[model samples]
Target: MKTNTTTVNGIDTQALLGAIEAIRNNPAEAQSKWHVTSHWKGGTRSETKVKSSQLGNQTIAKDFTIGIDEPLELCGTNQFANPQEYLMAALNACMIVGYTALTALEGIELEELRIETEGEIDIQGFLGLDPSVKPGYDHLRYTVHLKGDGTPEQFERIHRTVMATSPNYFNVANAVPLKSKLVLESPATV
Candidate 1:
């Protein structure tokens, strides 16, 4: 008997299933490492270079440079995206992936989907002027706009699943353990 190959909203479910099967067979294949190097420019301007990602024993090279800055009101040059914008972007992007993949897996074809996210930060905390203030966002609000072949109930279920499964969503929504090490640069000499 011949089986139908499925592709919904440009997502190849068969390929996704194959990857899931591969990871199931060798759980170690689920390991993924991402790397980036950032250079700080004067007055809140900086650039981060994403060079590669490591999956198991293989290194995949996909180079891209991202620039970040703050608005003049925040003492930055306002040249590129600010760190807060990037934070929301990362969270949205990760959740979108889960949304799309899950939609495809459910055999639903998507017509449109998007998420709007916003948050507030206390600068006083960052500036060390207020010891009790938190430097990061205390609460984040997001709204999802979705239209697809699936019913509203199905979409709502998928949204919940995405929230539970998205890596960056969990990272941002929870207090993840962070470790830091600092190495002072040697003074330049001519």
Candidate 2:
């Protein structure tokens, strides 16, 4: 099927779809696949726990501890993934994987790929100073480093493809509709 492209928040959506299609067409050369879930725990330290479940088992878990508490250690039962850092990590990881897969499918020899992301947040929202404001990232920026044997044009195309198609990238760059649902679990009396 032919993929149609649209621009969202400065990203070329059509080119991104083409890149993903190219990668999916060649599955044998993919690098990594994983899923993650996280839950928030309200209290001091503002901690959160994230788990990675795969193949019917919880294989890995990490704690995201934030606040002014001596920089939570990532060694014991609790680790740190401070909210902002986690956001950057997600973007970096997604871009690396997406770019790698796309390059492999396009027959480009990629020696190295690195991505760095930074985000800014407003404190007013967190402190409840403004009810109309949202407590989320105000701006995000990314820098990508690529080393390969492709022309400047090819490299630019590959970069565009990765930025447009990556799920994490889309989550931050596009206007995605989100819905919240509450599920209550209770014990049944017999």
Candidate 3:
């Protein structure tokens, strides 16, 4: 049997439209906050757990654990992806969502889409060997390979849309204010 569900590029356009309308009608519903915790395992190894999120005054439970490690040269076991990889992954995932949604909204079907990202960092600052060195990545360069029935102009438009709209894209391209606090615990606290 054939269904009348409206889908484009595997996205439910009908539901998407409905959600967009809902968010427009209730702007507070569009607000969300993600929460996670990272714990150091040992010597350059750490793991993060995504436990919950707040959306429009409602708590949403999320279950996800991600392992992180560094290369042997950096003093880690090379067990899992490093933080840099995760950052790029988040950026790529956000872009994927933007491309999928925008393309679907514009009635474009996608056959293939891939984004490759690379960045360079200086270890001197991390190791505290140099006072003038910056610890983070200098910059990240990425290439998107896309193939579909859309015109070159359409693809370029989507690319621009993703760059403008992707949350992780914006986060990485611009500096975001981070408010952090330190809590000291004694051995008997646990």
Between candidates 1 and 2, the TM-score winner: 1
The local lDDT score (0 to 100) that residue 156 gets in candidate 2 is 92
Provide the overall lDDT of each model, using Cα atoms, as 2-decimal numbers.
0.91, 0.64, 0.90
Alpha-carbon runs more than 4 Å astray in model 1:
1-5
Which regions of candidate 3 are displaced past 4 Å? Answer: 1-5
Go through the candidates in order and give the clash count of each: 0, 1, 0
lDDT of 3 at 20: 94
TM-score of 3: 0.92
Q: Who wins the lDDT comparison?
A: 1
Query: Best by TM-score, which number?
Result: 1
TM-score of each: 0.94, 0.59, 0.92
